[model samples]
Target: MGKPTGFIEYLRELPVDRTPTERVKDWKEFHHHMEEKKLRQQGARCMDCGIPFCHTGKLISGMASGCPINNLIPEWNDLVYRGLWHEALDRLHKTNNFPDFTGRVCPAPCEGSCVLGLNNPPVTIKNIEAAIIDRGWEEGWVVPEPPAVRTGKKVAVIGSGPAGLSCAAQLNKAGHSVTVFERADRPGGLLMYGIPNMKLDKKEVVLRRIKQMEQEGIKFICNANVGDNVEPQIFLKEYDATVICTGATQPRDLPIEGRQLKGVYFAMEFLGANTKAVLDGGAEHALISAQKKDVVVIGGGDTGTDCVGTSMRHGCKSLVQIEILPKPPTERAADNPWPEWPKVYKMDYGQEEAAAKFGADPRVYLTTVKKFVGDEQGHVKELVTVEIKWEKNEKGQFIPKEQPGTEQTRPAQLVLLAMGFLGPEQALLKEIGVETDPRSNIKAEHEKYTTSIKGVFAAGDCRRGQSLVVWAINEGRGAARECDRYLMGYTDLP
Candidate 1:
């Protein structure tokens, strides 16, 4: 404990965000960093709990309770509080390969499980983490460190998302030649396209990391679809080993009346194309646009929130988000407590923007889309929804049951289905002859990561199903460690 009373003296604080109305005007990041001295004070709020749950990295109640990468949170907090930023960055990099991405997008399970949160607000761990990494970049402290010697072993990584990138980076650090294949025009799979630019600046953050990885001797090949353009046998014959980080890209579809409507689209098709157009020039080539239209988003997860935010930026006339689950409580219920993700009502950025523009919280819980109504041109014109209740089925599983006499219809020119992903696209897995689990995810045990095929391993969403980017990094690093052992009969990478 740097100062025994530091936690008592300092309080939790974070960077202020730009006003929703102002930030919605442009697709740029809104959260501004706190001044350095203020940030150090925030870092001082760390209590140095003897058994710090903030870094436990355990799965409690089926959700991550702390830093999944097992970041040295307390050590770095102490370092930053003492004005040792360079040392803080070093401690952060010891575990997380890319704290920049997590600092922005992660839901901060660490804060939720912080011991201090039992009595007061948790330490501003995520903000401190982001500040340390951003400072490292500004000071030119983050640079390529290619291995001094090559191991004469080559590894092929399919997918350029966080998992594949982390895997390839770790293998390269161990002196193995690594090549990443991405089907998109650019690398950084979800980071480049799936996520909004305002949350993570692609050019400044994602591409910068890619550039460093390139300088570190990791090769990235774009526009290469492994199952279609490039044959799986090529990797098997050419590379010493292969790692499949092809994330769960298959979106769950809403099978309903008028599903073939023109304006109705999957959330990724909308988010991916918008990001592409943003990078290319504007939304000129965007396949779907919500401009001057009533937008209805199905699902209430992060992806749905993203859809709402994107629609607001497009100047949508009105917006409504529907979720089948009931609304969470404003505060944690007696059944729910700290050390687990609080199932409490909290407004995300998208909801905040929607409220600012539309004069209401757009989310309508316990409601589901029943059908879509389209105009003569087949473009969606309205959405039919109904209230639903959870009831036990014959098998004792809770299922959504539509309530009678509760049908409602609303104007909606654009309908975005952000119901989440099903599993990895099976074409590549089928081509590679890998077995799949019951959920259709590539069948690989956690940490073991080895697929049925010899010298072929799986990690990330493809293997474990949809999860956080931090979990992807964890699986990627674990897969690399096992792959290294497989290639050289021993391993050092972690």
Candidate 2:
């Protein structure tokens, strides 16, 4: 530890963000950077516990409890606390290939499981991480380190999202020739499209990294969809190994009445189109503008929150997010103890922005849209909703029972389906002859990352179903290590 009593002496602190009203006007990052001195103070808050659960990367109750990439949290925390930023950056990059991405978007289970959090607030590990990387970029310390010699073994990675990028980077470092294929016009799959620009700036942050990777000798091919635009057999014929990192992009649909309404759209379609428009000179052809519209977003997850934020950016007249599940307690429930992820109610950035714009938070708990009410032109104009209560059915299965007299109709001009993803589309997997689990995810064991087809591996959302970006990166790194091992007799990759 940098300071023996650092945990006791200092408290947790995070960087300030721009006001919601000020940030909504443009597509730029809202977070303000902290001064170096203040960052050191935040870093000093790291207890770096004897049994650091933050780096364990274990699963409890089917939820990730710590850094899934097994980041060397304690070592880097100490380095930052001592003001040895270059050393901190080195340690941070030792495990995570992209601290910049995780530092901004990750929910930070590390802080949730922090030993200091047992009594006081946890250390600002995530902010310190971002600071280290940003500093590395400013100082020009981060440079391309291509492998001294190539192994002459070729590998193809499908999808240029976090998983595919990390896998390709690691494999390239291991001296294998790696190429990434992206279906989108640009690389970074969901990173470049599914995610809104305000949360993660595309040019300043994401593309900067991609440019660096290009310099590192990793080849990226855009507008290439295996089994569609490009033949699947070409990979098998050309490359020694293939790793599929295609994310779980097949969105789950809400099969309710008036689903064919014109104003109704999938969350991905809206977000993707918006990003594409923003990148294409800030104007869209089929503009799905929320301006002056009463927007209702179905499903209260990250995607729903993103829709809420995006709607606010478009100057929506009003907004509401419907969640079927009951609201979580303000604090952990009796059954949920510390070190387990705190199942408490918290306002995300989008909700915070919505609350600032409106008088209250937009979420309606224990409610779901029964149907969409559309005008004569088949444009969604309202939503018919009903409150529901959970009860055990005859077969002992939990079912949502509609509460009588709770039916109501609310004004809505636009309805966004933020229900979530089902799994990877089956067509490509079928064409490639890869086995799938009962869940329809590519059949690959955790850590091993091997498909039923030899010399072919699967990882990320496609292999493990819908998951966090951190988990995807973990899967990518693990899959790369396994792929490298398969390429050679043994491997030294970690």
Task: Return the top candidate by lDDT.
Answer: 1
> Largest TM-score belongs to which candidate?
1
Encode model 1's per-residue lDDT on 337-407: one tens digit a residue.
87887778989999999999889899999999899999998888998999999999999999999999999
Residues 1-494, candidate 2, lDDT per residue (tens digit)?
87888878776777789998898887788889999888888877777679989887777888888889988999988888788989999998999999999888888888788888887878787888889999999999999999999999999999999999999999999999999999999999888998899888888888998998999899999999788889999888999999999999999998989998999999999998888888888823327888889999998999998898888888899999999999999877888777888888999888999999997899999998889888998898998999999999999998999999999999999899999999999998988999999999999998899999999999999998898899989999999999999999798889
Which residue pairs does candidate 1 place in steric collision?
none
**Per-candidate TM vs. native?**
0.99, 0.98
Candidate 2 similarity to native, TM-score: 0.98
After superposition, the stretches of candidate 1 with alpha carbons farther than 4 Å from their true spots are: none
